[model samples]
Target: MSSPFIVVPTYHELENLPRFTEQLWTALPQARLLLVDDASGDGTPDWVKSHLLYQKQLFLLERAGKQGLGSAYVAGFSWVTAHLPTMEPCTAVVQMDADLSHNPDAIKDLLGALDAGADLVLATRYRGGVRVTNWPLRRLLLSLGAAQYVKLITGMPFSDPTGGFKAFRPEKLGELDLEQIHSDGYAFQIEVTHMAWRLGWNISEVPITFEDRAAGVSKMSTRIVREAVWRVPWMALHRRRLKPRTESAFAQKRSSS
Candidate 1:
């Protein structure tokens, strides 16, 4: 039977994939995991292929090159919608990193929030006094500062607007023009949330203890930071001009709730 789908974007995450997937299944046994690999030259795709033989719910989408995180997730989302099509009881689509930074156990809290009427759930690190571990103070400050900048420019009140750990009800997410999301970095996370906000989706946050990656280098770079710095203000300015589909009345739901 089809179930809530998870889209995990990966690049050279071979060290964490096996452990993450195992814990993910234990956390949500009914969920299907869609691993989107951007040509991780580290044998990640091969390992996934072998595991698929036994783990029927585990699927892989191998890309030709190392695309950005945004593109990989967009591909995974499109794949899930096209192939799995969110049947009967399964309504949510989860997106997280392949590295163990995003705790697999927190999947329950996110899914639980969705079950309790949240149209979208953000697994936030700043909800309860900066729940991040192993990150230097400088890096933590940058993240916190960026979130504030996002709030000021785009008016998104999410504590972790740039966080990669999030879930959305498939029907709510389908309202977005997914193909038009071209941001190829951390900005992609913000753009998706902004789109959902513009359409008035009821977004909620669940505090999660985000940890440093157990293995693999982080994808963060100057380009990603630069994109977010400029794109946020640009999005806020052109949001109405884009002329998205009719919005749901839940637009103010996040703030009110």
Candidate 2:
């Protein structure tokens, strides 16, 4: 199997970047990382450019301003897809946070699930039980409630639908019309996974221990939460428009055979 590419979106994350990259590289030395910075004035881009290791293993995408997390990820994935043929090919495109909230050590479990034939692997904090660490009670409750709300609104059965830690097959990631994903914040997570599920992709979940970020402040805002609140049901109402990509590919294969 080829190495995976990790996409991390950052804004004012300088305090956490060094340690995060150290642990990430230690865990998956072969993997390459793409850090999409929304012009974080905290010397983030400068740090990336100056780091010796980053010269080969890490790539930076500097945006003009604070674009939302969803758009940053879309841009990163699109970069990977466009360059994979010319650059070193990767087996998967993994998306995670830069604040050390998503553990790098658990990345192997996600990749292992992909090797086992899952088209998309979600690093879940609620599969068997809640596995979050160092989070306040109210925040934990909010996250749990959001998961339940997503399932109730969208009829998607996956636990932790809003979790950002996930791995995607390169081809499947490439097939997505990134322009159609207009959501930001939690809604973006739900929308992408919902699209894959609707397309009959083989989705699976792996339990992971999610931790609160060790450094820097969170980027969450009331606006983001409000967006998710109204977007969930909208996605459900439009589910009929999604055609199963897997079934279409299978049909083509059968016809050829």
Candidate 3:
């Protein structure tokens, strides 16, 4: 019985993978996990195979060289869709950080929001007085500022539009014009939401506390941020000129109740 897939992209996260795998199953015991690791030279694939907890539940795809986060996710997404073509009760696809910044427990809330009818559920860090640990004030400001800029330029409703943790109903996402996603950096999140918005699908957010990675270096680079900032506005101005494979209507749910 194939179930929903949670696509996690990894670089040299061998040390973090085992913990993440354990946390994932605890929160989503039934969901399949697709971990796509770029050639991390850290023996990530081998490490995965050695983990007993994974058994038949975890799957890994290794690429020859380092690829951007966007490419890793795209590959993982394709693999899940192909392998679980007839997954009986239907499936949802999730993209999230492997660094533990996006808590695994929060996945339940995101899924709950989707079950309540959101086409896409973003695990937002800005909602309520949600806590984020170990982040310097400077980093927090820049991240929030970036999200605000994306929202103003793209007209997306969610405050955490730049957040990496999100889920999409597979059928709705499969029907998406996947090729329309051009930016493969931090903007990847924005591009997808923009696509969903253009398709007129229901999108909403759930609050999640984000923590800094307990180990390993952050992949966030200035270049990636610059790429996102430039690309988001450009797409906004040209959105009408582009055509997409049609699917759902972009409407918000009337009430949370």
Q: In terms of lDDT, which candidate is strongest?
A: 2
Tens-digit lDDT string for candidate 3 (1-257) = 54567899999998888788789888878877778989888888888878664546777888888878887877887676666543444457888989898888888787788889998888888977646789989888887888889878877777887789998886676556666565676788888888778778899988888999998988878888889878988878877444545542221111221
TM-scores, all models, native as reference = 0.90, 0.93, 0.89
Per-residue CA lDDT of candidate 2, range 157-190, in tens?
Answer: 9999999999997767755666688889899999
| All candidates: CA RMSD (Å) | 5.3, 3.5, 5.3
What is the model-wide C-alpha lDDT for candidate 2? 0.87
lDDT by residue (1-257, candidate 1, tens digit) is: 54678899889999998899898888878888888898989998889888854347888888999888998988998777666432334557899988888998898899889999998999999986889999989889889998999999988889999899998886566567878788966689999988888878899999999999868888889899999999899889888444454432233233454
Q: Name the better of 1 and 3 by lDDT.
A: 1
**Backbone clashes in model 1, listed as residue pairs:** 200-251
* Model 1 stretches with alpha carbons more than 4 Å out: 52-55, 86-89, 241-257
Query: What's model 3's overall lDDT?
Result: 0.78
Task: Pick out the ten consecutive residues of candidate 1 with the lowest summed lDDT.
Answer: 246-255
Residue 163 local lDDT, model 1: 93
